[model samples]
Target: MASVIIIGGGIIGLSSALYLSEAGHQVTILEKGDLSDNCSFGNAGMIVPSHFIPLAAPGMVQQGIKWMFDSKSPFFVRPSLNPDLFSWGIKFLKKANAAHVEESAVPLRDISLLSKKLYEELHQRGEFDFGLVEKGILMFYKTQKAAEEEAHLAEKGKSLGLDMEVLSRDACKSLQPELELDVLGAVHYRCDAHVYPNQLIKGLVSLLEKNCVRIARNHEVSRIETSAGKIASVAAAGERFSADHYIIAGGSWSPAVARLAGLRIPLLPGKGYSFMAKEPEGRMKIPALLAEARVAITPMNGSIRYGGTMEIDRINTRVNLNRVRGIVEAIPKYFPDLHPEMPAEKDIWFGFRPSSPDGLPYIGRSKKLSNLVIATGHGMMGLSLGPATGKLVSQIVSEQQPEIPLSAFSPDRY
Candidate 1:
């Protein structure tokens, strides 16, 4: 069995450690920050097979340009002089076409389905309940243009064998009769599921410790030692750690981490925000996505969370009040009766998504360094695809064939 060292203690790293340990490998996770607070802890907790199209789809460039002028817009690309951002922008524009979207759909769907199945299996084992429910997601649209777009995407999803149903306003209201929805129509993707991320993170950590996985918290990886085209060790927190193999899953910081190893991963940090409303007065049977606003609402365990806004900017946790207000205002626009009080700026949770230009995650071994594996750049689908990514990483570590094709998500695709 190979001794493995994984960078980052978020969902991707922990999930990878879980599968690696289960495969008889000795695993150690090196986290740069506190384990209790990270990217995977306070996310929307959505497991979506419905999102087959990548972020770099057609018309996104134009939309992003328009959203740039609005501070509260759902998607905003902050102007910057950083060379990495410039390079990423160029690559993003190149891939913003129908061909890239079509190429990404199958692999994205396959991995999501694999992860959904894995989540079910894990939930059935009675490890701990993190509110893993397959109630499906409701994508509600208020305008005719938005409805038509969703219908087209639903048709594409249906053709790909996903269970998608486009519902009229009355039909949507019939399914969600408890609350007053102010949308023209909805697309219910039955292939999706939801989870409470906070619970999942705590549960996974406990399970990993019980299984003898060493978790070094608050230990940041600084230097990567490479010799003879293979990773020798990783130095973090003034300590050198040696392992037979290394996996970098550091989310938004992945690119910088790779640079230490003489590699470049074209990734940009897309910041997003979320806030929870405890014991909401409105009733919600399932999670819902407000299409026009790009906000996601999930009724987790006991509280309700509203999350949205993807800001492509530098790595920081600064809370933009305008963006927070946008989420607050967007909530009532869809759920007419569910106008919960807006969360304070301090109460909001924000994190950076490791977004790749083409919206495909890097999930394979390094071509130059045979022992180093790259598994970051998941963008908005990290939670939805974590387990499958972990499982695939293990398969790669064991020299077994990956269950799904890796061409689309290759690290060298650029």
Candidate 2:
């Protein structure tokens, strides 16, 4: 078995380590942070097969333009003269068409289903409990436009063999009887699930360590040594770690990491925020997506996690409380009884999602580097798609056929 080194200890890197180690390969994960929190941990924790439509779909450009003016809008792209943003925007505009969405649906659904199945298997093993719940997710919509959009999405999901049903306001209330909803209706994505990400990440780290996988925390990759079109070693924290194969799973920093290896990964860091609020009443039995507001609310660890907003810009430490206010305000509009308070800046958790121009993740072997794999660009679906991406990475490294076609997620597509 080959020795492997994975950069960026988020869900993608950890999941890759999990499968690589299971395949008998020696694996090491180099994490810049202490692995205490990341996009993997702070998310709403919904495993959504319902999100088949890529972010680059049609109408997004117009909607994003309208949102840019709103301080607390769900999506905002910082206006900038940066060449990277300009180039990414051009690519995004080119792909935001009906054809692209139609072409992307199948690939997205397949990977999502694969990951959901893997999650179930992991939960069944009972090695650790991450509070994996398959009660499904509800896409709640108050406006007629949002309701129509969700209904259309439900039809598409059903056509793709997913279990989805458009429900009336009464039907929706029946599912979560304790909460008083003011929404017009909801689409219940019965194919979706949720898990407590904190437990999942910690449990995976423990399991990997027990299986002899070295997890080097506080070690950030500073340099990539290459020779003959292949990576020879990675330098981090005054040490050089050599491995037979290297995988770049560095979340939003993937572009910087790839640059060290003389590769350009067209990606942007979309910063999002979330906070945990008390849900002592257990009013929410199912996860919910506010369709118009673009907020996600999920019940986990006996608390409700409210997350939203997609601010496309350079990764930064500043938290925009206005966006958090948007999330808080939207909750009461949908479920009138559930009102989340505006969390303090210190309480807010933010993470950068590695969003690609085309809204599809890059998940294949690099064309320039024979022994290198690129597996970031998951955007908001990193946790939802982690295991499947990891399993595919293992298959690629083992010289076996991938369980699904990789043409859609090819790292060399650009």
Query: Backbone collision count in every prediction?
Result: 0, 0
lDDT of 2 by residue, 46-155 (tens): 89888899999999999999999999999999988889999899999999999999999999999999999999998999898989999999999988988888889899
Q: Residue 202 in model 1: shift from native, Å?
A: 0.5
Q: TM-score each candidate.
A: 0.99, 0.99
Judged by lDDT, which candidate is best? 2
lDDT of each residue in 273-318, candidate 1, tens digit only: 9999875554788899999899999998678988999999889868
Error of 2 at 397 (Å): 0.6
lDDT of 2 at 127: 91
User: lDDT per prediction?
Assistant: 0.92, 0.94
* Candidate 1 local Cα displacement, residue 249, angstroms: 0.5
